[model samples]
Target: MSVDTATATAPASATTAERQDVAAPSDRARAWLVLLLAGAFEVGYALAVGGSEGFTVLSWSLVAVVFFLLTLYALSVALRTIDVGIGYAVWAGIGAVGAALLSPVVFDETLSAAKALWLAVIIAGVVWLKLADRPERPDDSDRAAHPAHP
Candidate 1:
């Protein structure tokens, strides 16, 4: 439900600074509009997953999967204008925490105080990673070249 997901990345050197021309306020507004749509989709997904039963649950899972991917897409679009670390931190932070809270509030799920504390610690770690803005990706060229990830 937290939609823990990753973004596809090319080598940092392969990234080029591209210029975008938005001549109209409508375009800017549309960006926010899509963001809202994506959030709405996530909430709907969480609700569906909570309510679903039987084979319907599988369908609901698929819906959640699509919603999660769409969320990543929206985050990518947002990151076009925002810092990658900031955008990633906010997206995952809000989704994970929001989902955890909704599980209890909307679905009558138990959120034991200990579990909540552990989740809080994980969120804090994410915040730290965001602040650090890791300068180098782990060396993974060999891993990428071979499926075994030696």
Candidate 2:
């Protein structure tokens, strides 16, 4: 039996909507992961810049540059799937919190009680934003009216 060339080369029959529905959760998860990575890189960049002493230190400046590029790339990758406002807020929040929390350990900086409290608030806000972005699932009542898989 000879296989039809057209059929052999054709793509999967899944519709665009079906594919998006199936992939949306995973894509969102991956985007958030990348955004977190970007935030980590941003924190590294911030710390390195501090250590660089206004770019006078070659090694620290180089490290800062590397982190800068990494954070930008990862942030862009994440923004492709996530809303720009939400992604940017989370990224900035993570970077700010990480850098502030680590400053005392990495440098001659101090974290006052007020500063710590505010950081906690920022952390809470970031968590809330992530929660808000969660996709709503259809309840069992709705499932009967609108089937999951058509």
Candidate 3:
């Protein structure tokens, strides 16, 4: 007459091994790498869209579509392990910073010093978010309490 909470909460097909694999450090690292790639693709997509001139340019439109698909796939993969909010904010920050920095070279756009300063702020925020996502390590107090037995 009693229900097993673990089984009740987990998906029917999920095994202990599967859960462990999901939490593996390597998997988390790979997810973050994939997220960075996704952000790169987002920059490409944004530039291509601008070059497309409202999709009038056939080549640029095609390029934009390809980058769009690539970015979406990579984002979904990363979100499997990363929190959606953190993953999305980092991805967007990368795209915005990249596009702003490259606009002059790519499209004869101007990047004023003021804009550059704001972009740096965004970059700093993204870096902080990434740092915040790191797994917590035991502090000195925790270490003192649980001394290693050698």
Candidate 4:
């Protein structure tokens, strides 16, 4: 049998759109994803801590520790690309709102309409934070200096 390493090792050429679908995500996108995951873990951590009852319960205590570590890891990953101020605020907001809403159902806590409204406001603020951070697309004159990548 003859070897055919050329065909096997050759790199594939793809259009920009196709490449985008298959390519590793941009730093910003990955950071946002990590931030969101961190926020979710934060909620889990809060719940676990409450369930642990000052760490007296071994199982819940372990759960709290695991979620806390995971949340911190995700936050650190996100910090690589995301601004600490914006990311931390958004992450903490998500955790707080998630925990508050979930607590009523999961831990028999109170959930008033005011609390829900305030949470919605926090979500809106986060959206604005993201929007404000985005860089505007270069105009035609500026585009000449900074061409689009293939």
Candidate 5:
């Protein structure tokens, strides 16, 4: 999950001065890994909240709020260099489609070739955006949101 793709369309007026400072690439990458962990932490939420008794849903709800904050922070890092529109589109699109498939696999929910095919198409779009856009990284003056991952 590279951030460059999410930061393509920074405001032109945003001079080097306005750029939110971030840590080094390795640090940024580490932060993102935490974000990823936060996401993985959410799988439990679905199981707990997807349809549970009363308090379980409330507990999962609070957990979900935390997950949302972490996810937003991670996206902000990615969007620094990546285009916001592309970044969000890919993020939400890929997430929704993947979750759809994952639910079936993990929870024994229904799945069909047709649904899988559509999800494949959507994921392909994500790959294509990554390839086509090639958003720039932060300038030397700017803080790095994520360290280089590969």
Candidate 6:
């Protein structure tokens, strides 16, 4: 077996820079957009399921299934870039608020002032979570391998 010592001992800084370059802002933006699309599908699935009456209604049941799969796929794609915790919370918040607001029209459900206030709270929480998140990038493992000062 031939050993490539030169490649093995390449400075860790190069790896760190490469990873940093990989975490592009455009990718993050695309992730957020995909997350939003997933949330929208969530709302669609919820409404379809509700209308399906436990799969008793064939057309609505099919719609629900399609939306459910789409939601999962979109969420998984977004998770490649977005933090799972923040991504999921935001996704759930969007679905919850959207369904709650939409239920009245779709299913003749009720939405009181208290419900509105709670939905607003959920929105605020999602915003707060997003703002609190640190920009994603490679961790300090590379730095640990090769101390910055050294």
Model 6: per-residue lDDT, tens digit, 1-150? 886532232243444234224446676688789999999999999999999999999999999999999999999888776767788999999899999999999998999999999999999998898776556444688557755412
lDDT of 2: 0.84
Candidate 2: Cα lDDT at 38: 100
Each prediction's RMSD to truth = 13.0, 6.6, 7.6, 8.2, 9.6, 6.9
**Model 3 over residues 43-134: C-alpha lDDT tens digits?**
99999999999999999999999999999999988877677788899999999999899878999899999999999999999999988876
Kindly list the per-residue Cα lDDT of model 1 for residues 21-126, writing each as its tens digit.
2112354345445554555556656666666653267877777777767777886665554345554555665566667867787777889899899779867975
Give RMSD (Å) of candidate 2 vs. truth.
6.6
Q: lDDT per model, in order?
A: 0.56, 0.84, 0.83, 0.77, 0.55, 0.81
lDDT per residue (tens digit) for residues 33-127 in model 4: 88999999999999999999999999999999999999999998776556678889989988998899898877878989998899999989988
- The candidate scoring highest on lDDT is 2
Question: Model 6: residues >4 Å from true position, as ranges?
Answer: 1-21, 136-150
Candidate 6 local distance difference test against the native: 0.81
Off by over 4 Å in 4: 1-25, 136-150
Compute the lDDT of residue 23 as modeled in candidate 6. 45
What's the C-alpha lDDT at position 53 in model 2?
Answer: 99
Comparing 2 with 4 on TM-score, the higher-scoring candidate is: 2
In the predicted model 6, the residue pairs found to clash are: none
Each prediction's TM-score against the native? 0.46, 0.76, 0.77, 0.73, 0.57, 0.77
Better of 3 and 6 by lDDT: 3
Cα lDDT of model 2 by residue, 3-106, tens digit: 75323321346543333344456677988899999999999999999999999999999999999999999998887666677889999999999999999999
